[model samples]
Target: MNLVTQLPVSGAAPKLLDFPAPTVSGLPTPALRGKPVPPAQRVYFYSPDEWEVFITEWASGLSYRQIKQLGGSGDRGVDVAAFKTDNGLEGAWDCFQAKHYNRSLNFSDAFPEMLKILHGVVAGFYCRPDRYVFVAPQGCGSTLDRLLSRPKELQKKFLEDLNKSSAATRHYPKQTLNSIREYAQSIDFSIFQSLQLSEMIETHRKTPYFAARFGTALPERTVVKETPVTPSPDEAVYVKKLLDVYNEQDPACCSDVDSLSVHTTYGKQFQRQRESFYSAEALRLYARDSVPDGTYELLQKDVYTGVIDTAEANHPSGLDRLRAVLTQSGQLDLSAHTLISVSTLEDRQGICHQLANADKLTWVDTNE
Candidate 1:
């Protein structure tokens, strides 16, 4: 379909199976098997297990046996169904409407009236659609996000469903506890009762979309203590990149025009710029330079800390590399809170982008 959000959906549900409107002399000519609909839009193409996860959540919330009532056309436009939660209350929620696509769908077909057709969904469920959430997987368009961002009633409905789903299972991030935090930060989802969400994410990572999307998505972060200096694994990568950059920019070979020959060679530039990144004085104290506790204080205390450190603990310059990012240029706009959410927490309910920063080095945990 060209533009799904605006397609021609005037009929309660398009006769998906029937092809070119059949015309009989008297009665409707038996609808010819229409041009085949695309596989992506066809219902049977979806995974049954994943559908069940959504179905159970949706049905259990409203105490419905099944959504079969709306089988082919009843869901109104529900692509994924699930129970929703708010505070601690639960409700059957229809969500992940195809109307709200996960990332944009690339279509070879001409959908001149996709949006207009899709709006019929709004009309279908007009009298209390229960809940409406559009999944914009590749991330919502800025304009669309802005439009949806402050949708108070819509927001409330979304949150209510999420919370309800969470509460029924005791408020958890069945997908990934850490993701809850990320979502809260990225999309500003509420975390008023995040603890409950955390437990759920940990225990329920088996749910279809939950497992697929949030499954094992956390980053690996570790600290290396050599020369008694503390740096994180990512730091090593940053420092390596920085050193390469610095080596290129060092003032070694000069242009004959100015004849400042010192700014041309990598070796000479390395020698000149090396001091800033790896000072003789700092190296001399490396064995004795212990990280101040204030830094790690930020990482560990996030509501979503990890169970184990990480796989990259062996690198000596990891943490230092991250530190360099924070204290240097080309790297700007950082704060402890932002740094705290750097990595993808194994837990999934928290945002760990703090570690995602090049400046995220390991500092001694003050609270330790």
Candidate 2:
């Protein structure tokens, strides 16, 4: 009997089905997906504000959730700050000042920002940061880079530049240029550093939101198909072998082969096996679906190479072996569109045996 669930036309929630809908494993459905951002256009088109967002996201990896972006009016001197707390006492504090420039940043370009840091510290607007970074699309030029590497040389340059500037003399707490020089002399110019565009991009890639940044899908894995309700006699035999491998005792084996998953230990092992199976299956399926018929085997060999390289390291436990297999899965370069063409879990288990007999894999019993 077909049961149709009805809903309200407007201003009220619709009646949900008595039974929940089926869901796909390992797939996430976000409300908004990343848009396609071409590499060439990415850096060129992003504004200063967009750059701050990028920096904030990258910095979060280092300081985690402690990194904060100060965007509104009264930010004192800091643009972004990363604070660390240890033993209930304030630990390390770092600040990043983002400068978006089309051309390379020179000494003159950095001077103003340096003055703000000095003024903020002296005036007690904020405590001095352990590390102060100048972030820019085009990093400091050769002259500034050399000056930064030498503390004495940088300090000399700062004073020399400040003395010649009417802006420094006119502004500040009514102090002579010499007073400013005395204050600057006491400061540790070595705390200053620069982070360029390339470094930020590299850090960003390691983050979970990496695909979202580039508007690309995450690395694809094999799609799971719905198994038939009735299991063949051969299916039952393979299921028992799998149950034994997972060390499941008193498994209520049935025509529904997936029922073994109810046992706690078996469930965890099944997930790990499923993940490895999907990865290996993606490679095999990719080979079959290639433009030219015979190319699949070549691709399969490449996948085998990746798997062997990742999994060959001596692992003491089943958990370690499982991790190695999962790592290899992430390394596979299958597309989301093509990865759906995978074999059933039973078929993949057969392939694992094929690999074992070929000496490609040695499925040793290990404590998980």
Evaluated with TM-score, which candidate comes out highest? 2
- Among the numbered candidates, top lDDT falls to 2
Worst 10 residues of 2 by lDDT: 1-10
After the best TM-score superposition of candidate 1, give how far the Cα of residue 29 lies from its true spot, in angstroms.
50
List residue ranges in candidate 1 displaced over 4 A.
Answer: 1-75, 81-93, 99-126, 152-368
Candidate 2: which pairs clash? 287-296
Query: How does each model score on TM-score?
Result: 0.22, 0.50
* Segments of candidate 2 deviating more than 4 angstroms: 1-41, 63-65, 86-91, 176-180, 217-368
Q: Residue by residue across 179-274, what tens digits does model 2's lDDT show? A: 446668877889888876777777766654454456444444446544434444534443444445444344355223466565554565554554
lDDT of each: 0.31, 0.55
Error of 1 at 211 (Å): 6.9
**Alpha carbon lDDT at 130, candidate 1:** 44
Q: Give lDDT tens digits, candidate 1, residues 1-368.
A: 22222223234542222111111121111223656443223323445444333333323324432332234544434444443333111234433343223343221110111122223333332211244444322334444444354554334444444444332224333443233322322333221110122333333333322212222221323432222233346335433443434333342432121222134544343233223333322321221222212323333333213312331233234334323432332222223332223322221211122333233433222132
- Cα deviation at 192, candidate 2, in Å, is 1.2
